[model samples]
Target: MLVLGIESSCDETGVAVVEATGPGVPVLRAHALHSQVDMHQAYGGVVPELASRDHIRRVLPLAQDVLARSGCALPDIDVVAYTRGPGLAGALLVGAGVACALGAALGKPVLGVHHLEGHLLSPFLSRDPPEFPFVALLVSGGHTQLMQVDGVGRYALLGETIDDAAGEAFDKSAKLLGLGYPGGPALSRLAEQGDPEAFKLPRPLLHSGDLDFSFAGLKTAVLTQAKKLGDGLEARKADLAAATEAAIVDVLVRKSLAALDASGLQRIVVAGGVGANRRLRAQLDAACGRRGVRVHYPELALCTDNGAMIAMAAAMRLQAGVQEAQPLYAFDVKPRWPLQELAAA
Candidate 1:
């Protein structure tokens, strides 16, 4: 089956093609992505209206680029899949609308994929794929969660953030440090020059004896520390960035290990934008290595929201016989879909 996937869930517009034979992981043919980072940078955040309009302009061209790169025509695509929820409503609608239109025009079935599910299943597209029955750490956007994933569509939430997510902590902390938009990566880059132990930062819920996470306190601590730094802030920005990253990564790594222990699962998969952090991966590698537990992560390019993950996820769901593409054209998007709901999907 040839699946053409579209993703306009956030600031990036992406399109891709994947081929699924029968059972097993699918093969990604080609993909194209356009980042609205420059557009959103001026605003220090995403503007839904601009993001939606940009998606409208970029999706078709990106789709065409994917088709051309994949050496396949639109008619060769058996299913049109799109991110249907858990994003900006207008941005989600753009992808869903385009996918439904393409499906209707091509007389093919359309599949609505969960954005986070796409992230969860993305590692299957990597060279070294993880097997079933593993712990998954999801740290994307406004969400931070740990789930026991038995297989495709078989996910049980083990724990999650009670307040601000890890990504939020990164962005918010970076913003406080005078970093611009897309602060997570920017802050991470700056942290390399500073000492992770230069400043003491709180690690929330690290010893709570449960799998749940809380970064709100940590973010507040960063704010308080930055304010206390006064005119010395610029000289100590790198140190602060490093300390912040350390605190966030420490909580995430500890909680992930705890999740693995709680679920009695040795294999762990880390997915989402934060998974791209070198420090996080390095620490996870060291921690999981000591326990002889396996860890899987998506390729750096696939860490963010993209159409390839959506296509791969849809193909996997089809291969697992958990979902079927529908011929129906009418479609709706969920801007606040929960990952746990995939158990019922």
Candidate 2:
């Protein structure tokens, strides 16, 4: 079965084609992505309306490119899958409208996939795909969560952020230091030059037990430190960035290990944009390695929101018989849908 996926949840417009065979991991024939980062960079962040317009302009061409590269035709696509929410409503509608329109035109069933589920299942597309019954850490711009994933549709939320997510902490902290838009990467890059112990940033909820996370206080601390640095802030920005990265990474690594110990699951899969953080990956690798626990991550390219993950997710859902694509062209999106709600789907 050939599953065509479309992703326009936020700042990226992605399209991909995946072919599923029997009961194995689906093969990604081809995938393409167009990042709106440069466009949104001038505005400091994503403008939902602009994101939606760009998706309209880019999705189709990306779809065509994926089809051409994959050596597949529109008629050969067995199902059309799209990221259906927990994102900007306008952006979500663009992909949904296009996907549903395509499905209607091609006489194929369409599936509305939860955006986070795509992130969670993305590792399956990697060269070393993980097996079932592992813990998953999903850290992204809008969310940070830990889940016990037993299978394609069996996800149990173990913990999550109560306030600002880890990605938000990175971006917001970087913004405080005058970093440009899409600040997380900027922050991480600068962090490489400074001492992780420079500014003594806070590591929120590092010891409250349970598995919940909180980073809002950490962002506030960064703001306070930035103000205290005054003119020196410019010179010490790298140090501050390193400090902030350290604090966040410390909490995440600790909490992840705690989650592993509590669940008795030796393997953990990290996904979403923050999962692309080199510092996080290094720290997790070292920590999990010392404990003899295995860790997995989506390929860096797939770590961000992308069509490949969505197609892979849809294919897995179908293979597991947990859900089926529908012929209904009428569709709606859930901008605030929680991953837990997906367990009921």
lDDT of 2 by residue, 158-237 (tens): 99999999999999999999998899999999999999988787788899988999999999999999899899999999
In model 1, residue pairs whose N, Cα or C atoms come closer than 3 Å (at least 3 residues apart or on different chains), thus clashing, are none
Model 2 Cα shift for residue 129 (angstroms): 0.6
lDDT of each: 0.94, 0.94
lDDT at 331 for candidate 1? 89
Candidate 2 has a TM-score of 0.99
Q: lDDT of model 1 at residue 170?
A: 95
* Candidate 1 wrong stretches, greater than 4 Å: 343-345
Which parts of model 2 are misplaced by more than 4 Å?
none
The clash tally of candidate 1 reads 0
What's the CA RMSD of model 2 in angstroms?
0.8
